[model samples]
Target: MSLDRHILSFLRALVSSRERKVATAGVVIGILYLLNWSQRKTSAKISLGHRSKKSNKGTVDLEFFKRIIELIKIVVPSWRSLEMFNLVLLSALLIARTLLSISISSVNGRIVKAIVTRDFNLFMKRIIQLAMFAIPASMVNSGLDYLNHKLAIQFRAKMAYYLNQKYLTGLIYYQMSNLDNRIANPDQRFTQDIDKWASCLSNLYSNITKPCLDIFLFSRKLSDLVGAEGPIFIIGWYFLSGIIIKFITPPFGLLTAQEQQNEGLYRACQSDLVNHSEEIAFYRGNDWEKRRINNTLDKIVKHINDILTKRFFMGTFDSMLVKYGATMTSYGVLGLPVFGPNREKYFARIGNDPSSITRDYIRNSSLLINLAKAIGRLVVSYKDLQSLAGYTTLIHEAKVVLEDLANGKYQRTMMEGAVYDQKSRGTYIIADYIKFENVPVVSPNGDLLIERLSFTIKPGMHTFIQGPNGCGKSSLFRILGELWPLFSGTVYKPPMEQLFYIPQRPYLPHGSLREQIIYPHSREQMEKLGYNDEYLENLMRIVRLEDIIEKRGGFEQVEDWNDTLSGGQKQKVAMCRLLYHKPKFAILDECTSAVSMDVEGSIYQHYKDNGITLITVSHRESLLKYHNHILKFDGEGGWNFYTILPDS
Candidate 1:
């Protein structure tokens, strides 16, 4: 895509997302309205009026609006002059939101009722009926909702994955470990918050769109009942009510953000114990850790209480909404007689004999009541919507990193799957034959580690990395593997498919031995990697697992891997998997450290025979003979590279 088109695509996607949110919000509201409306039969209303007590007149029945203004002046004198504006705007929105909520709840109620009654056919038909109205609107809303959520998740996951990948990239992980905890618990943000934000994104999207949708769709349906002029007045009331809510609510977004951070921070302290329970027991730091965790918890809870206080103040507007709702009823009392003729007037409203006009008058009054009830719900929902906006902003902050990670420029690559066309060979390469320059990896805060790291291991060149503990050997390995970016320099490799990074403790997913063997590679790719049934069988035997395979499972049948395998057996299985992949260079970050020296030697020997370039990190003196050279980091930023000879 062209630059402009890509930008447009992104914007259009976002706008489309917002539109969907609005729509889904509407559908939920609509469904609620329908269900709620179904249960509620309009009760017979008595046309009670505000009697005007004057010098000559005994009791003149004033219309709804006069009663409204009187009530508004009495309750909130601040809204006295702008009472008409207040009632017109505030009341309608309040009513509309309420109506929508009622509708949604009612629809939900009906759906629930249908399920409860086991009246599937009626439920289905009711669903079908609502679906006709809701589906299209919901489709738009749901589509928007899905898009928004997907964008959010994509954004969140990308950032988290990126930061995670970046933090591990250039020994930034080591730096982050040492950095003062400004971000008290980053793991909370990465693992839990990113996931929670991603997962709850749909709900957040709905929260926004649903209320606005309630306002719009509810207004649409309500306007149909109330007429165009009525909607105008109603919207005016809605607007006024919204403004009041805005005035009452401070920018709680920052507060909410802080609260989440604090909560995560507190959780992080608790999680530390859970993750290190064995270590705590081993060291007998039980009281220390508990005290430490509790201190963190206390800090978090303190912030939470403060946030709740802010929320409580902002929420006091509900009382205001209730007051305005009563005022709107007053306006309705005034409006009735003013709009209709003298025959429709309240003084002559009741007759000795009840007639059809009396019935119509009663019906109108009830419609007015229904309209009023809807207004109240709309107002309350608006306040809630404002509250959720804070969460939405936090969600947006997460998206930034996610987008960059997922689509940012390609970094140092060491592997490529076979590209059929030689014409495409020169396309992606930045410089000449894949090189690794002096790369200094650092954090976003500019903390540095492992500087002047320049090493180029060409294809089929087996090299090993040796360093003392915490000298960033694994970090360098991570950089070499392309999981972490080189902060300053470049790592050039053929493509993504030609190399593999094997860690100290290889990750074993909960699956069969067969499944575990080809963990990341797809089934088709597993075949391409030359890891079929027979190849796997021979490899298992090579790893001394022929008896285990035969006794437990041939190929098709297998037990749960974690439950079945011993620690040594798991290590051997990992070695077998490494052989099966057959990548050009395998960067092993102490992968075989758990195995005995003899088994480790055999695994290395297998690599030598296969001609696979081996880049390994190990403290063991026994494994050095397999590699032609060793790149050693001396804790300081300095690194020494030298050729080693076994026979020297």
Candidate 2:
């Protein structure tokens, strides 16, 4: 009976053990399965993120890096240039600052050791050394700031010059505004965007360069003091944290770009208001203008607020991980050399002196803290880098658009019922005489203003063009001046220098009365052409603007001429300018409308006497005697030419 009982107990015990083992194996497999599922979920999220990033317009990707490289070349230019030399000098200062930091850390340790050991003389000596070191340290810091600002200014100058060269060369500025619809508010881009980009780029170089050097030097020092494991472990922790932060970081680059764009729009709205304040007031459209400006302002504010909201949450996590968490980790690393398993080995070099141990602890602590801070700065710079990417995207887009315009490639939003054919382009020929052969007058929006208009005007053959509003009147001049692209046929006109255009609203620049007459030509240029202010005075007298010169000031006096001059006076100034240049052909588009009929006829007679051929667009019958030929538009893609009788 006893043997049977023993056999039953043994079998029951064996069964219980096997059940426990099976249950343990099931739990293990369940945990592994959960881990696999989590990993797949994370991988799917990352993949989705990459895909979404590619589609985002302002994403900082490989293309952004390439753009950065290209822009950097523009900012830096050459290794032998002044900018490069400044960079090299700045680098030297960075290295010097790092060396000074190391020395200060050592001196700090000695002072602490002296104080603990009650050695007043040694403490005094170390204190004197620290004070002496501070002078160069201060200079190095100041030098860094000065160099950074200087580099920023230099960078902006180079970039602005490059862009201006492209913008102002050959009718590009006009085409950019009138023909292409890609870039908005190029004025804002030149002034604000470029400045911000250059400043950010300059600061970014120092921010990144200094931190890297600090990390390398401090890491080396820490490794020597507390074994390679301490620096390696802390660095690895930061590396892991950086990766985690990257995943949590929002698309700051895209947000910054959007914010800048909205800011530009807001500025443009205000500029438009200022430029047309007189017209708006005349129409009592202040309320409407206010609403338009406020709407733009609201958009900018909303975007900026969104950025701030995101930054708030991001800043909290960043502070916790990079600041407080790093502090705790630093403490742990610092304690390892003193209280860890190999603590005795670390103490053997200086014996068991408390002062020596405290000194070593302070120095090691400084080194460790510096390493952590360096890593933290590197992590923080990711945000600045993203912001830089945003500016880079904007400036690069402007550059691409400018280059495209220079190459005669344009993209415009077509008007309804407009026709555009990419393969069809008009022909432009440079000749001494003006002629159009089957040339279709098309607006920038591809509107067919005149299907096939043909006309010719040789020098001394003054012609008058009469047409209804929007009946391809100014469109013809635009085509002739190359402001609007020709769709088909041929156009023969004089070189731009030999052709002058005078609109009803004369453009009086910000300069003296002399400049108003010889505009686009400086005093030196006027002198080079063997002309003087006296010559300009004579031309002004011909336009009846003689007394106005002394009334305002001398010829060298400067003012906002557009605002200061009356409507008639402004027109007279334009006529004076036309006489000054005395081009072969003048396209006067209602230029003398502001002047009285007497003065107007006299100005026309003056132009005719100067041997300048006039292509006038006007409705004034009184001036018909000045023109010998007439070209009339029927406002429906048709035109006719007739010779005016001598009596009429």
Candidate 3:
């Protein structure tokens, strides 16, 4: 009978609240329409559990947060001098906001009390108090929001800096791409995902902590007015709504992670198309590329649609359970002051007559409703919680992988057995030869590329390496540069500072022509090293590239060098950069492939004239004349080294 009475009271409350009826009807209609539309759609499954198996396994589990907490310990100190101060200030601001929220609710209740009692003096006094209280409340809230965003930005910059340092340290980035690749689109993770993670995480701090604080403070204030029943009933309902919402909310974390992964794949595919646009155009493969891109897009759209469907159902339940549901619950509980067995006791505590008691009931009920609404908003933000979890997982996993690579925990096996000779001390630094002592080179995945090879490049010796494609001609250079690990035996080369690498497709960074010539080094560094474009122009003239620079006005014109220069012209700029650095040993791996033979010859001759020991990897027979020795691979893990005859 008691349960029946409670149910009857709840229904009566809902009927009396006109806004509740309208909102409930709208939500019900929207949910039904969506369900019908979803049934008609064939792209998504009705069941939330029917997600991709890969997404389930790869999605960041709760353990990811444990790891993130550990990583936070490492990154938080990166705030330097503001570390403890930032924490203290943020805590204080959040507390201030929570207290202000409670004060606002109290003021609102007081205003209701004043109006219902028909006390004009009390009404004006409360209004004045509210006005004065609102100024500092608004200011504090603004400061809290500002500090929140500032802290998030600072955290992102610190974490990004750490990731950059780890990624760029000692060819770990190369190994991650080639050898121990565990994550896709690491670039995207660094550029886009980290920022999202920071924002979500910052917002999550407030969303979670503030609600907890409000529940405590508001419940205490409510207990004094309606005794224990009102606060207890509201609290229990909030938790019950949360449990029901959680049961219906899909695996949004997994779906969001899958969505981000698909986005990365699409971006990677688009980048490939841009990089290889000319080749695809030449082959007239536009349709094939479009189909490939569309396939990736299809996956993205499917995931997004699934997420929306889940949100629709969840949002409907949340609205019905939180908005109207809270109103009904609050009315049933707060109605005690008017109709409960303890009504006389409640009125006696306020020491008021019927009209004054009625006014007190209005003020107290309004405060109860306000508190319930605040808790409802918190409960309804389950989607935001899921997004936060997804981002946290990605960032945590990426941070772990990056830190592992940086710490040498995920090192390649080839690096374990290789030897580095440090015989030359600091005095004169005389190790100037390149020696391959019975060396075996293997691909990143342990596929043998070369076996038991031995050769040496004497000082001032120009060598040409020849082989069929995928026969490890370029792999040899990777080994020599220590970018790839040696499979077996030893590779002895001059210190990295004295060596340089030039690949087939040169990378033209976004900067001025002068910066291009002195890439990876600023103009200030060039000036400090006593090098400048005045001498670089003469080297370009030797390679027949001076006219190209002159045509562009001068050497310091800032532009997107990659888009501005042709393949051959880009190769010429690379040669100019090579000359500017002028290392003792230059590894040219088809670096002049786009240039004409005569221009290539001129570039090679210039290296020869400068006494730069050249190790060239190319298929051009014409290059044989520029080299003093030939190291030829037989494409079967065997190679032969011989001096080039003067005629041959």
Candidate 4:
């Protein structure tokens, strides 16, 4: 129920809200011009890339907010003659507007008639008009496009705002730290997934409006051309075309989706190649990486080849339909009308103007030819767009996955007014993140790290979990902190705000030294946290980082701290942050391996003095003396968590 509600909430956020429904109104405007593709006239317009006003474009840029005002002015009863004036203006524009729709059958007849009579001059004129018809159509299309675009942006921005709010709303992030297995990478969902969603939404909004416009406009044009006969012929042809399109469309859309997946996989491999570049170089694994990359490329190539083969065959068939459909329909439909029979035959006193017969013949024949080509091309283009939209649905699906992740997560309630204590079965607990029952974690790929385990921790407690490399020390820390979920277990934890976990290689966010320490806090928060200039300076001095503090501008924020700080400095910076946060509990995952033992011992002593519980991961016996509890993991598989006994 929560997940369903989350999805509903996400969709609601995407479609509209009270404050921004005005922008979503643009979607309604786009539908107005979406039907017809080709027009006979051209006008000034703004391209999406530039969005600047142009003299040649015919479409009006109806800013969403501006349109509301214009609408209000028209409908108001007290607005003297405003509505009347708008109607007059609209009517004038409609009457002045030149519409040109050339039917496929009519153009075919004209070409046949022209060819039969060898009247090349007349044929050329019709062809020229047909060529220029798209300009006006495009302008009207562009106007509608602008409206749809505004709506898409509004929807995207609104959804992004809401999704972010929900994802970052509470201690969901804290509880989720323990349940990583339950959730995928949230970052990927936020960045890549959101982009796909926006793009898909834009395309979907355009398509819904476009097809309805096409059906209405095309039906109208056909009806006007041949009266009863035209509508029947056009509708019948469309039905037949749709059936054929259904069969051909699926393969291309499927192929496109496969291509996307293959591409993403290839990119992921490349990323791994880049991330471990130093390792590969030092171990002479260049050849190995190269071979792996080549293998991936080869696999992708085969899939693409299969897709291309199907695409080419389908393209050939579609082209055949369009090319011959234009040629045959133009001759039979238009030529038969103009040059069917002599209308002035057996007329004795009729005005014998040969030019009259010729003019009528030319007009009827030529217009049919132009209309035929224009309408045929439009149908083909529409088919291509439809197929592409179908394929993009997968992209939309991927986007929704992220949206779901962002909204759906487990909520943790901290035990209020409660403190933790160390236990015999604890993996490592000098402080909070005490585990009562921990089941082994079995990944989908069948990798097992830890078995059923249990433990506890308390404030002001100092403990250490020691094991050989990769015996799951860090993994245990993660599970205890509730960042990595045990396949099955319940973990009791203090309020998240009261605890902090420090990694082996602490991450430096893109910010200054002070910002790094008080990370994710705003500029105003620095002062609120009792972090004055003198305090910052003294902290740096204590960490032996006075030179960097002085050099990098005190409290004046560096843009990128990761590149600026060295390994030792970053660790010390993390410690400084630990001191600053003054959390009751802290987890150190080999956090001081880079620093000297003297420095490490002093930091531990400082934490003890401050009455802060310290959980340290280190190989140094010198450090273990400070920790009263020893949770030792045997290198093979078994482990023991017990109080340290001082013995000879």
Candidate 5:
């Protein structure tokens, strides 16, 4: 027999006699028990797979819930907070909406009964009641949507605030980017992934919570109208169908995570192109970039197509069982009270009246339909939940890494044959003068550039450092600036505020020219220091950039200074910034490499006249006249420090 026919035959046999009814109930209970056991076993396996720290991307198991709970704490911090109030109000609204639905269903049956019996007055009364309900019904639905989106925005805001705090706190951003290898694109996680996670969380809350409330309320009302067995059979049928669908469902969570990863890669590729457009154009690497971009796109397309195929088949099966099959089951349940052998029991209340029978059937059928819809939504939420798990995994991984970095813990994939010196940790101290006592210059990736080095720059001592390329010149500055971790030996330096560093390629922020000159400072701070725009203008003249202020529309005008200024102009602007800060010591790492020779000489003389000691890194012999001492690296893990002869 076909499935529907078999189901009908079984339903008929179930209510035929007391003995058959008992036997059928036992069989159903046993089958449900077995299915429940099997489902638990499957869930256990899924949980085990997802709990694996190395491969825990897409699985929805206990670990997924754990991550969700942890993130929830961040989004909704306190019970008395606004988020909690909104949640409670939203829950109340959902409950009110469900109750309104039940009332509407009853009114619908009454209207149908009045029409069949030709009672115009009764029909009109029910119609007016429904019209009155329309206002609150609309309000409830609109409120749900408004509150859901508001909560999502709040969640996103809270999460972003917390993450930005961690990201910008004390060189964590630099350490995360340079010292960690776990998160490939933290930028994507911070912006896109967090937004998605917040939205999914808000929608999932309503989707799952409302359905659960519906199931409970609808099942109770259904039992009252159609006897206990009627609701039990329907609920049991849906339960079995849920188990079947769970087993056949695809790993959508894993697929979603993979899709997001590919998207991040593609975005990163485009960012790289933008950042290096000039270099790429000079090399004519357009074809190479296109191939790489297309490769990433292909991966995303393939992943989405795979998900679509699985969803198609899964949706087909889901509709067959949850929708049409439920309709068939409703017919059987409806007949149990009116047409079964126990019809005599309901005859007095229903009273052999066709109108009464029709009314009960309509009302009972509406309840069953609503119940089926609620259960169907619960089943469908499984897929959404899986997608949420994917987002949760991504966000949780990033949070873990940030926390690890904050705790001074890091993990990096070291270069081949690079030995990390675990026992030789360097010490840092604050002093009036700068000194490095047997400090090793080590790169972030465990490359030891200078095995041991000693140097000192006391007050009035202008020291010059020269090294071949990759001979730890930049590495030393990174260590001094606390961008890289100190690895070995004792290093003493003035407070960070007393030391200023100017790199070869200056970083011009997207702001007014004034902000560029006093970067790491605000316009208000510049004013409080007894300086004004005229003082800034004088600093500009000293760096031979006197015309740039008027050329770029004054100091208050904002532009992309990096693109607007020429290379030589950019270096001059950097020099102007150094002159503005006027720190006791300045580390000039090729900062004047792009300036004219005369301009560079005058810049060094200006620093000498101001009594700002300089630690200059340059290969230009012309700068040797301004420095009293030299620290030279030979590129073979060696260095020397000595006085520079006045003539040399």
Candidate 6:
């Protein structure tokens, strides 16, 4: 065979075989690996630059602009449907206001003409026309403003609802807060920042649109009087002012975001002081706390001062340009006809009558000046425009962070942590067996806490999980609860509802005593479930919380339960909740630490009698009698599972 025929025969043979396909894939992967190795050997720095260059490219992409437009569309809904009737109504009012604005300008011009001509009849008629126009103009302006206020409230409510849905979905709040901590004071962003954004948006729509409309409408009138040169001069002035303002303006967006973060930090410090008042008071760290708070306050003040300083300079420049420069530019443009070739023609039209000619000149000059001033005011409000930009940028970034989290990018980061079971669904459920199959526990920062851990607790088999702090004891529970992602294995457990986790410090929401017991369920829900005072009284008696009902009046009374309940009392309430729900598996992390041994013992026995499997974590040797199995962590990635003997 010829060389070409031999090569063709080999190619056909390779295409025809399964093994050859596998070999082809291997070769391609090897080539890619070699290429990566070559790049690494040649220049690791340039290899790293590939990632950063991608990020830099994204910053200036159309997606960011599209996000902005989408956000604005969310804030200001279109008038396409019956649901947008309010916006349609608002638009009508805005159009009415625009018409009134034009009328007001025209009336001012007529009043000037009436004065210069000095016709008493014409002057009186013009005065009455001005009065009538002013009445409706003021009414329209106020009515439009009132309508805008309502629209703003509605818009804000809708936007807040959408953002709240995103922020609170799944474990989004927890992931954003604990796992990433990228968005600061998401609470304030939803409340204060959203409020500000709504207000800015309302004003921005009106301020930007109305000025542009007025400039266009008035410029036409000015053109009719002083030719196109008058409006051209004012437009040129605006362009010049925009250039100067853009150059002088600071990075207001970054500054505003920093200000918000500082505010959250300062507020957090104050909140900590309040929440841990007893701890701080016991330590007598009032002076230290004062200094810390003062330092935070100092930071807040410094940021505000920086903002104000920038604004001060901007204000000075804006005032000079708008107040004085606008007037001079207007007069300069108006005086062109008087000094130029048009002077002889302008006087000849009035037959050498200086008064009539001067009167016409005055009326036209005033009209031109007013037109210039309106446009100038828009240019001067550029600071507010910058501030609006700042708010939108922060909101957009937050939106991006939230979307990334929902897409599981943060949770699935290879070097950072575990790959979560993204397809897992359904609420908490406890099956007949709770099993871990070669599960490895890793921290959020990817440190191995436990490795290849396999264990199973069958029905009626109570287990005591023993480990030193930071040995992944509590973290193991987090993975089972699906709060933390699993590393390299599956944890076959019941759904969330059938598994209950009781932390050391129980969460006590402010409500009636009855609400505290059956919580995560409302009084209304309990009532619907056929629960009554007598039933609740029975549950409390079982948990030995009967005294609490007597001391706090009745179950109907509402108070700050966290403050009112003692540590032991809180734990007892949690037990009552546990017994009330009666889950198949309960993970108690030192939940009975505050309670007396007698009460703790009773609670454990009650769970055993109820056929609820217990996974308990505690330092006390007192809890051993209630369990059959022991899972001990060696403070390394090693764990041991053993049976608890009757004597030992």
Specify the highest-lDDT model's number: 5
lDDT of each: 0.55, 0.85, 0.75, 0.55, 0.86, 0.74
Error of 4 at 379 (Å): 5.0
Those runs of model 6 whose alpha carbons end farther than 4 Å from true positions after fitting are 1-64, 76-78, 81-91, 109-125, 278-288, 334-370, 411-431, 550-553, 645-648
Model 2 lDDT tens row, 1-648: 354575588678866887778867866985675465446445534644764565353466898889999988997889899999999999999989988888888888999999999999999999999999999999999999999999999999999999999999998999888889888888988889999999989999998999899989988887788888888878887887788678767777777877888888888888888888889999999999989989888888877886786687568658867987788788778877766667778778778888988898888887887788889889888989888888998899889999999989988877787765644787888999999999988887778888888888888778999989999899899889888888889999899999999999988878777888888898899999999888888888888889987888879888998888889999988888889888999999999888999999888988888889989999898988999999999998889988885422
Give the per-residue Cα lDDT of candidate 1 at 305.
Answer: 75
TM-scores of all predicted structures: 0.59, 0.90, 0.85, 0.66, 0.89, 0.81
- lDDT, candidate 1, 1-648, per-residue tens: 444575588678867787778867866985675454333211101111121121101111243224323322332345333333433343344334444444543454455556655778978976875565564445444454455555455545544655566555543444333322233455665676556444443344345444554546545653443344554665566567666665444334444555677687678677878867778899999889889878877877876775575556445445545455445643544344434234234345444323323433343344444444445555555434333343333433333333333443321222244212111111123332245576664432344556556676765566778777767776665555554545555766755566776776567776666777776666688887555788888888777776777777566665777557777777777888877777777878777777888878877888778877788887787777788778888887778877785411
TM-score-better candidate, 1 vs 5: 5
- Model 6 C-alpha lDDT per residue in residues 134-173, reported as the tens digit of each score: 7777877787788667767866787788788888898877
Alpha-carbon RMSD of each model: 20.7, 8.7, 5.8, 18.2, 5.9, 19.3
Q: What lDDT, from 0 to 1, does candidate 3 have? A: 0.75
Q: Judge candidate 4 against the unseen true structure and give its global Cα lDDT, from 0 to 1.
A: 0.55
Is candidate 3 or 6 superior in lDDT?
Answer: 3
Residue pairs with clashing backbones, model 6: 427-496, 428-495, 428-496, 428-497, 429-494, 429-495, 429-496
- Candidate 3, 144-211: lDDT as tens digits: 78877876787688778888888888887886777556786888888788887777667766776667
Error of 4 at 359 (Å): 7.1
* lDDT score, candidate 2, position 329: 80
Error of 6 at 40 (Å): 42
Query: Candidate 4, after superposition: displacement of residue 502 in Å?
Result: 1.1
Pitting candidate 1 against candidate 4, the one with the higher lDDT is 1
